[model samples]
Target: MTTQKALIVGASGGIGQNLVQYLSEQEAWKIVGLSRSQPPLKSTAQFIAVDLLKRDDVVTKLEKLTDITHIFYTAFYGGPTFSVPVAENLAMLTNVVEAIEPVAPLLERIVLIQGGKVYGRQIGPFKTPAKGFAEK
Candidate 1:
């Protein structure tokens, strides 16, 4: 059987990178990693430098992918004085969803990290809109 293909976004972040390594180690998957600076991860061979915030780029990349079977998205825009992190994450989540919308025609799965929900403002500041891996 042919190996499955996976596209990973936010590959420079914690969960993203870990997932890449884990999936690559599986040796059953063809992994494609995406990032802004395209920072080299544990496995550099499967990497694509992309700024997900750019709509055109996202659409173009998604269009070119025909073999992708799954996607793991961990991108985020985080900061202080934020009540919209949830909404922002929802938008980005939608962006990733839409980007892969085309691939969905052929893909088997797409996973976005929602992490454990942290309710209220709490004692400290919220890290990222992604909930887990907040970008600096």
Candidate 2:
């Protein structure tokens, strides 16, 4: 039997933390955790302290993981986390996706954690679509 390797992009987060705990015991996965602020965790996972906002840095780091079989992208930003526009946010995500483009060929799945904002976090009629999302 072969063990699968997973790259988790939000190691310090609530969901990311929980994932590490669960996958650690599976014995079928070699976990690689990515985060800017890493909290205390008990898992036999390779944890990397990275800030995905820096595209080059992130790309360089992820380039080393060519055998990754899955990606758990649970990274998020709220409050004072990001200062870019909505389109930029989407672009940032797109850039991150691009970083994994090569490695993704071997991946079975890429799970990105999204919430209500998927409907429309920001809505405007400025030569674009309208109907913003309601606050949670």
Once superposed on the true structure, which residue ranges of model 1 sit more than 4 Å away at CA? 80-84, 115-136
lDDT of 1 by residue, 26-86 (tens): 7678888878766565663377676666777777766777778888877765537534366
The alpha-carbon lDDT assigned to residue 120 of candidate 2 equals: 41
TM-score of 2: 0.75
What are the C-alpha RMSDs, in order, of all predicted structures? 5.6, 6.1
- At residue 75, candidate 2 shows an lDDT of 70
* Model 2: residues with Cα > 4 Å off, grouped in runs: 81-92, 115-136
The 10-residue segment of model 2 with minimum total lDDT is 123-132
TM-score of each: 0.73, 0.75
Candidate 2: tens digits of C-alpha lDDT, residues 59-134? 8878878888888887766534323246545654665677877765777888887533434443322323433343
